[model samples]
Target: MLLGSDVRRMLPPPAMGRFGDLLAATTSDTSGLADDMSGDRDANAKLIEAFRQGVEQPI
Candidate 1:
């Protein structure tokens, strides 16, 4: 998902406060989820699952 990484790149400034924090979907490493968007169907599934799990976590 280049789109997903692009969206993260577009997160608002922290001047936006908690909403900014909520929208900032970055991993610890700046490389991002797009790096994982390779390989077969199973790989994509794994990434989607990981993203789902991350989304379910508290901001």
Candidate 2:
């Protein structure tokens, strides 16, 4: 996720008008998603799902 964010940040200036609008929309969507979350519930759910999937195997 951090890598994805970094790549988005590194994208060069938008070329066409539509491309600029797309970039703006994507940024707004990301900001909205982050702001829509309330507390640790979202974080906890993510962690739980990760563990359930065995992606982050128990230590």
Candidate 3:
């Protein structure tokens, strides 16, 4: 979901760099862990709407 990308994007530069290093050491493809949010817009929109609905509901 967009939350994962959003959280990664929020990471400090130093931490993000470290994460990239770790990914490089363990995985052949680290593109998914990149600090980019250029993911599926439609999926992100649906997630946002679901989140909003959850927030508006009572506990």
Candidate 4:
């Protein structure tokens, strides 16, 4: 997932614009998905720290 994110980040502006258009066309509603994934910010930070310490998997 991180690698995919990195690849998407590397897309050129025109490619990114097309990607966004495709996504918007396919997805009817993203707000609910966004809300579902919007976890605790502090917990996320702690999890990231734990991953960095090798105590947790990146996934």
Top candidate, metric TM-score: 4
Q: What is candidate 4's CA lDDT for residue 26? A: 36
lDDT of 3: 0.49
Q: Count the backbone clashes (under 3 Å) in each candidate.
A: 0, 0, 0, 0
- List lDDT for all candidates, in order: 0.48, 0.43, 0.49, 0.46
Q: Model 1: how far is 12 from its true place, Å?
A: 12
TM-score of 2: 0.27
Better of 1 and 3 by TM-score: 3
Q: Judge candidate 4 against the unseen true structure and give its global Cα lDDT, from 0 to 1.
A: 0.46
Kindly list the per-residue Cα lDDT of model 2 for residues 1-59, writing each as its tens digit: 44333443455545333544554454453445434557675684454344333321222
Q: Report lDDT (Cα) of residue 54, candidate 3.
A: 41
lDDT of 2: 0.43
Over 4 Å off, model 2: 1-39, 55-59
Candidate 3 pairs with clashing backbones: none
Tens-digit lDDT track for model 3 on 7-30? 456667788668655544533334
Extract clashing residue pairs from model 4.
none
Better of 1 and 4 by TM-score: 4
Q: How far is candidate 2 from the true structure (C-alpha RMSD, Å)?
A: 11.8
Per-residue accuracy of model 4 over 1-59 as CA lDDT, tens digit each: 35435545666778866865654443324323333446975564444334333311222
**CA shift of 54, model 3, Å:** 25
